[model samples]
Target chain A: MFNYIIVGSGFAGSVIAERIANVLNKKVLVIEKRSHIGGNCYDYRNKDGIIIHKYGPHLFHTNYKEVFDYLSNFTDWRIYYHKVLAFIDGKKVPIPFNFNSMDILFPEILSKKLQEKLLKKYPYGAKVPILKLKKENDKDLKFLADFVYEKIFKNYTIKQWGKRPEEIDSEVTARVPVCIGRDDRYFDDKYQALPEEGYTKIFERMLSHPNIKLMLNTDFKEIMKVDLKGKKIYFLGQEFKGKVIFTGMIDELFAYKFGMLPYRSLDLHLEVIEKEYFQEVAVVNYPNDYDFTRITEFKHIHPIKTNRTVILKEYPKDYDPERDIPYYPFFDKAAREVYAKYQELAERFDHLILVGRLAEYRYYDMDDVIKRSLEVFEERIR
Target chain B: MFNYIIVGSGFAGSVIAERIANVLNKKVLVIEKRSHIGGNCYDYRNKDGIIIHKYGPHLFHTNYKEVFDYLSNFTDWRIYYHKVLAFIDGKKVPIPFNFNSMDILFPEILSKKLQEKLLKKYPYGAKVPILKLKKENDKDLKFLADFVYEKIFKNYTIKQWGKRPEEIDSEVTARVPVCIGRDDRYFDDKYQALPEEGYTKIFERMLSHPNIKLMLNTDFKEIMKVDLKGKKIYFLGQEFKGKVIFTGMIDELFAYKFGMLPYRSLDLHLEVIEKEYFQEVAVVNYPNDYDFTRITEFKHIHPIKTNRTVILKEYPKDYDPERDIPYYPFFDKAAREVYAKYQELAERFDHLILVGRLAEYRYYDMDDVIKRSLEVFEERIR
Candidate 1:
């Protein structure tokens, strides 16, 4: 009865489902394992009117005006710039480490001298990568690069990745950099804001079209089957003619014909504190002191008047597919080869499409996932 | 030959002259006492290709889209957000004092507690004036207000105005505020940028029309005369029929008819340092230490590659009518009363219109002067 069968209700599956149903005026069914939509972006307001993300802190910021303009149709936006402070040497300094961090952490004379060298050597607002900065030949610059790596990036990388600083791949090592300017914002996107209503409300508006039907608490595997040999899809014991957009893990769709792709998960411990506020900012990273990577207080994100505040502590761990939610895909060379194999196998079935962080085995921010989904719809589905 | 006469080449006069010349296609003459145009906004490139402001730093930033749009016709804008730091307790902190300043100045525990109280009490990203904040009933918030006033505002006011902290009027005390959030930028305006070309270029473009005649090194009092009792104006032995837009000092134009209005002038000490750069940011306030109020490095504003840099130290002093150039009209109760008499006397002449900081006897920023000129053109000139 439906023209398209979406295997997940995340941004990847939902955006395409919405376009197909509204733009083409065709019937589409969305299947989901979770009771709600919005995938990792899902957030709900508690009794105290504080919107809390069920998974973790998800901030929406993008430089693409098209993406922002497209999303503006569904929800009103509130100006929000995310700020993070990393606990280093008994003081909390803004990260990705910048000149302000240099001032708070170093001695007055040394800090001023270091700043002079940096401004002279680099552009005023350039973000110098830790790995690239480490390659600098200048004595003071080299010292600064090393000082940043050892004091700030080293311990954080170990806790988040479960590997020594040197063991991490060079490509992954350059992700965090030292900002030359004093902008303390975590992300320097041109457009930064949160949905005025919440992310869940945006999903509700996108899927409210008459041609769209949703199935909660129902996994696609329960009613849909992929015949690997024949390269065909079957739905409810009948040969399904509709295209199947798979957003779940690519390896699982073929029933682990080759092997499982590696992933990292998190243990989110949420607590209710009997105080007006838990911290100054929304998130604070304990790089050197704790097992948990960071603590996020929801009151800062969605301001409220209640005295009781909620804070979440995140503990990174190896992904256990049987229990934990897969948050990030492992990006080492070996994992890429395994993911390429699954991608090749899925291409053989013309009706099967792979998208999202899980299906593509790539890490995507909220705006990145939406941008990819919009592009895929034009290139493949349309 | 001129249908309108403008007394100064500042924003207030130039904007009016440009409008009358281009929009109305009428002849207008601009009489500037200074040798060059652009008055206080004039800047020139030194031998090292550094664009140095002759008077002081003049940054353009405005929230009114119309004002930005109007100025966009003359020159391209370079995104420039002014960042300032004040030396307090041997550490440089951002001011208008913010949460970042609080973190660096106070003990960590005290800073954290003060931040919590501030966040709970005030809206994020608010510029709460020192006078208003000092009236807070909450104990922690009250302590924070008093602490900020003593550390950042008190001595700076004394240095700039040459008055004890208690002697300064309440109206002037509220100008600087404690920002609730950590935006280190001196301004939080929606549009903040500098002209890619020097500000003098803007004035050159403004008065470039053939109908706009510029009279350099000529005081308006030389060719123009105002009869206060008769309410008549004569230009060069002829009865001038058109409106005379006066941007010079109101007291000087009327020859201090009632009494001399007080003004404060600056002794700018421009030094060319051998060093590549002077300080981190463009401007740094020496609140407690230096004889001068602040030091401004020109290279920081207009970035260029040169070993030698230019810095200006401003020493505030009482205005001398015979030898000194008036920069600011002293705003006190007695000064305001005397200024009002001149204003009332100016209103008696139908063809005489007064505008700008000097004529209005008020402190007007660059944007404010432009905005006022546009309004006056619509209301009085156009």
Candidate 2:
């Protein structure tokens, strides 16, 4: 009898299995349907001899020190921080719209004056609103906002969000802040480094311990007939005997009796370029004129010594039932109401737990996931 | 001589100017380079008589009752929630991968086993690590993680991050969770809704105050020469008599003395389709198998009653100093170190204040920007 039968070898399942096995020295079995480990974060050199992430681009950024430190134990560190740029007005400016951008964007006199005005308005650590002109009755002020909207946010927001500016929340406009100074950093978190060797190394190290067992290219159904009794169940399969652990979605566990929830999926196209570098930055956003949101280059993320580079052109498409690796969990009210029904059904079970982004139906960063998993482990194991 | 000088007339600038002018009875002069208002969030009808966001799509969502109530003063609210879907493997799945996806994605026996295993493992609210199998020594458990990684993440990650999963961060893997159940909703927020009329209408009302003035096709540089002598200066020009407010880039403000900060850029290609609706969801993500990110359809975002629809194809590219808009700021350690120098230079000037995401060089959601702006407004006005 296994101490725990964990399902899905993704972040949630892998982390729990290792922790439980390491802490209690119990026997753990991890089941995966695909042909490899590391779940969605797995990476390897492709036929093009370029390092690639099978799932998608994964940049690590967290404000939590413990999460960073914990992951650091498994893999070496790389001092890489993600960068994003947008092609607009036929010019390249630092993303998040910064002060340095003005030099390249606006004429000398206009840029200078605009700088002075922003400085005075934002004295101290003040943040000015993008909707500053919204409540104005003055024709001039209103006109001014209209001008800025047309030049800066209007086109970009439309292409990105698929809605008009006024239709969006003022808060939405607020996300794109006007900068007073010249800082052009993509992220402002203290911890913006990358894994030195790679994420795969970390997974390899994390799963190298003795107490755990793994099955690749083997679905949970393969083990369904195995008798599971008297074991501290960590089942990540269809059936659980004792203390089964699930890291999948919460709604499907109950068989969607409350109706189907929504999710956003992704489709990617990749190519290998015969050059040392394809683009200077890691990712570039096309806000104004594109159906797609952005494109990514591998050299920026991997920094390999090979001359051949790989790039990914991403296109967003509707999620269909027949084909997709359901990625983003849709958490709208209707879906939530449906999910609530499933949650109620799940509550009926005494030995089952739902976890992770899919199970909880929340948008969580990497640190949050680890933090959440640790919290559960601390509570149950001790 | 100008009685009142307004900097940006977007939502923040326009709203504040309108409020101050109406409440304080002051004359305001608003200057704008672009021919329109609403800043980056502006919207209008195009040649097809279809309302569109000239810049990009925008969606409005907020939990703050005060914000909703405030915006409600302008236009009637549209009872619409944002929805997104992703097309993967020839199927359209709801975003935020849900339970119903299981039946569509996996074989019958495998799906059943996966559901049961996930439930058993996640019993009683226990959150497990998806990367747990990587830390296990058992060969079978390790294989499970590897399998899922290849099918779900390996190819996708390579396309998204431009790096192999091993080279990327495990935290990123943690960010993408698999759903055991199937349900599809785009966002998890309960307050997700859009304005019924559109963003332009709301802007018109927000900036209708009497004291505020309007100026279209007027750049900030043109107004710098018209100086204010005695009163407290809210300088929106290059040179100021009193206080100056800046909302541009910080590094360029002082010139690229510390060397140009790194940033990513993009290029976009847009097209108009005659169809009533292009896709089912608002946005779709392509993590693999594409050079571009995804395609966006305007009809889905706005849902206006029209026969013509617009769509855009997005492409991500490197930021050239001469081309593109700085949408995302790159936050590498090197960039921050350079920005630190600029920050110190900014501190020396007491008459200038830097504000917004541009000045701060941080990633903020729409609500956070509004909140930040409000905080700054409270500090300045009071």
Candidate 3:
């Protein structure tokens, strides 16, 4: 009989299992539905002899050194900085907007003037909410905010967030800071890097330990039938005792009592080119006049130079109940209300600790996930 | 005659004009190459009276209080948070990877076991890499990561990045972090909000200062024919005498001396639905098995409480010199080499300040752009 049963093998479940077994020094059983492990941050070689991120381009950037260092133990470290470009008007511009982009897309004079104007407008230590001098009657920097939102963020937001500037939470804008200085790095962090080896290797190392049991191609729902010792946790709704840890969606765990939460789905078109190298950058964003929001060049992320290359065309799609994988959770009032109900139910569990992206319904970086998991162990499990 | 000439009425240009004219009491003339004044961030009412971001949906999200506070002066604030979904194999999963996902896609038992395995192996701070993980590895964390990358990220990355995981830089993976705790809020920040009225209005206010002059449907290339009081700055073969602030691409500024950088472009398929609302979330992503990458419902972004709705289907394409707007910059070694040459030439301009997304050749968020521009002003212009 196992002392603990955890659901899913992604960061959430993996973290929980490792912590519990290590702290309690008890027998732990981890079951995975897929043939392999790692929920979404998995990487492996394909038939085409290309090492690809199986789900999507999973970039591991974090500000927390501990999380960074922790994951480093699993995989080798690579000094990679995430660079993105936006394909607009037949020109390649850096993603998030930057210098060096001006002359490529715009005529010289126009580019120069625009730069000067931007510099003058955004002085150092400017305060939020950006207040435009002209629209005095307007509050909350609506006028100037709208202007930036339109050009810098709007269409892309519509494509990525599936909403307009007005519909999104104000916090969304807060996440993407407007820079007064000219440094074009995707993330603003002192410590940013990627695993030299694939993220899969890191996960493999994290999971490869003794005093643990792993079953692949096995479903937790089926395992629920047998009586198990200890507490049972239903991640995907399989009954298991022995301190069950659920990492799936909270609403799904409760069977969508508050109506299905809105979620945006995606469709990706992947192709390989015979050229030794493809695009100049790793990721290219489509902000205007594009069916796809972005294109990713695998070579940009992985560091292996080869004669052949692979790429993925990212297309946004509507969440379909019948035929799609839900990637993003819609935290609209309706969804939130539904989630709230599930949260109540989840809180009722005594031994079960609901954690991870799925359990919490929040988007987190890899480091954040580790930090959060560790926090849970420190506060509850331990 | 205008005392100061400002090109491009986008946020970058408008903000500068407004600040200099309003605060510094300087006369400014604004010129826009596009027919409209707001540049790429233009939004207006269509025939249906439904507000549509002309360029695209721009969701304003930032972390800097100053940037947000500055925009507050121009317009009112709106409170909205966006959600995204992924459509794969006929399933809708929350984006950024969340809990409610496994139930609809994987079988109940399998999903539960997968969760268990993840927890068992990971076991909170295993301090071991998944790669080094042994068969007794309870979490199979690495395997799960591989599974996610394969099922979702792999194909999508190939379509988005144009390179395989092995070939790309590790930095890409680091940028996308996995979540350990479930919170499904795509971004975790203190402040999240948007512009109340829209983005275009903000531009109008920012550029409406008395010291600023406005010109639309005019290109700086045409204006270069007239003389300005400044040193002669040569871009490729063209010469300019005014203090030039470039916001275009670095390669084009140098006339693609090292050869034009490769960038991916997009083709958008738009549809105007006559319904008040459509879909559950705002954005949806398609990882693989689709010609297009994703679909976006405009109402999710705008939420105008209208009977009319708009949506866009995104498709990725090879950037053609003649068609499509280049959105992302390709940072291949060749392009970088060419950019290096351009950089050398750019240094000759004592009065010129290269700014915006293109001039820098680096990926920048809106905050980054604003911050960068401000830095240039403080260090160089001031």
Candidate 4:
């Protein structure tokens, strides 16, 4: 008998499991289909003894102090500020189209003029997305916006989402910004660093509580079949007294009553080389040129001193419900409508608390996932 | 009888083969120990359909028009200007420590001062090596030089050569330079490009001549025991009347009677990822961080539109006489003395012409090797 049964061992479920065991003194069973924990955040020591992320580069960054502080309890910090470069026109330039980038790409006169215009229009440290800048009436500003959109955003968006920049939702394009200042960092977060011992160590510490029972390589569907018994929850062919916390797909939980929700998955190619290091920075974005979105050198992320290095290349793929695990949820009108019906259906069970990126059918950063888990614990579990 | 017995099918042997078959209209036999042609320059489409350099990234760039024009007969050019970035202090700055790199790494005042000093000391397009720059008398220039040497050169040299920076030859450290200008390119050659169809295609076209017979998976040692018989060449239990061009290690040819000349070998790790592209550039160099020297993303070198990408990492290791294929000759005084003895022994046979990087015991760029082959043909073979 468990006090709560949590599906998935990703950040969402693990964070909830930690809180349930520590804060509420409850016995929690976390069911994960994958052999390993941490879901997309799973990292391990390779054969060459380099710590590598099995998935693409998961850069831990957030503006939320609470989320940062909570994670700090689990692992020490490496204080890594992530910076990215995009290969365009046979040159590696600073991404986010900052002032330094403008100087690198454009002519002296044109770059100066654009810089003056940008500084005049926006605050010194402001970050304006290409889509918002594209709506500008000024010709110079429009030109700058269009240049970034075409060179850096368009092809990447098509490859990443299988849709044109215009066809995709504005939020997708809005994530990539054009900075007015000379700060070349990819993210402007108050808390930006990698776990000193790697992300896996953090998850190891968080889920180490005695009350939290982790059952990996076991799917939620296999453990218990949920059914409605006159407005009472019955699971595993019995009246389940424990509360159910489903952190997997909401539509899958309800057996696709509103058809399948769309998602974008990634196929990652990881290689270990006999070299000490590879690449300039942690990640390099190939927006306009290559088929893959970006290449991440793991040594740059963790700075491990080894004779060998590991690198991962990310290829954007269409999620197959039967084959692929859901990664990024596609947020469109059709998806929203399908999710709304699922949300309404989920309301029938008071004991069932649907949460996390997959269950809610929304995209989330590491910090947001942690914050969401904390909020869910406070509102429902407590 | 063959007109020429060319040992090793790399640039050295292949160039001679092409020249002999086409220019002199002579029959030539090329013996390669490796299963494939092109020697170290051999690149092939792997299982994932991405072209990879079996050894490492080979960027073809040369100032000599004759060398470039001669090789141009074999394959079309991709017109690729190679640029490298160094991962130092958590920033992706251009290598060669150019004016732009100074701006990225140092404070505004210090960067401006150093820029002015560099411009004043060197020509607009001049590249001054770190060792040369370290000899500067000016306080500002010395600081700049020391900064680059410590950050970019020292650790990389230590890991690469297995020796301290001071212990390594000055010529070795003299190869990596500091640019006076804002040019972020690794090389400032007049002709800078890749073989449009990959390096293997060039070798394929070069060796496709009817007169050129390629015998792969065959070493010269296995086929023949070389001995001077009254100025007559004998091979494979038969009298061979042909010019023997040896491109393999000269010391190995003598059976290491004077003790084996030292050489460094590379262990390459290759991986095929399910991504379309990886990294912003073809090669990323890690100087201060990792044990491996660099990581090369193949798609950036040859842009083939595919859902997968290939990467190669190079790990430098001490050459084992029995196990490793000698890639780089150690230029230490003791090694040079041993090589001198081998050269003296090689000079005994009038028909035996020692050629290429390994045979000559010197590091030669792609163009230099081709140029040396032409010169050798004119002076000796012709």
TM-score of candidate 1's A chain against the true A chain: 0.98
The per-model lDDT (C-alpha) reads: 0.85, 0.60, 0.63, 0.82
DockQ, all candidates in order:
0.00, 0.01, 0.01, 0.01
Worst-scoring 10-residue span by lDDT in model 2 chain B: B227-236
A-chain TM-score of every model: 0.98, 0.84, 0.86, 0.96
Best by lDDT: 1
Runs off by more than 4 Å, candidate 2: A47-49, A123-176, A218-239, B1-382
Which runs in model 3 stand beyond 4 Å of their true positions? A47-49, A102-110, A120-148, A173-177, A225-241, B1-382
TM-scores for all predictions = 0.50, 0.46, 0.46, 0.50
A27-54 per-residue lDDT for model 4 (tens digits): 7767777655788899865533356888
Q: lDDT order of candidates, best first?
A: 1, 4, 3, 2
Clashing pairs in 1: none
**Pairs that collide, model 4:** A275-B292, A276-B290, A276-B291, A276-B292, A277-B292, A292-B276, A292-B277
How accurate locally is residue B259 in candidate 3, as Cα lDDT from 0 to 100? 70
Native contacts recovered by model 2: 0.00
What tens digits encode model 1's per-residue C-alpha lDDT throughout A90-166? 99999999989999999999889988888998899999998888898888888989988888888888989888988
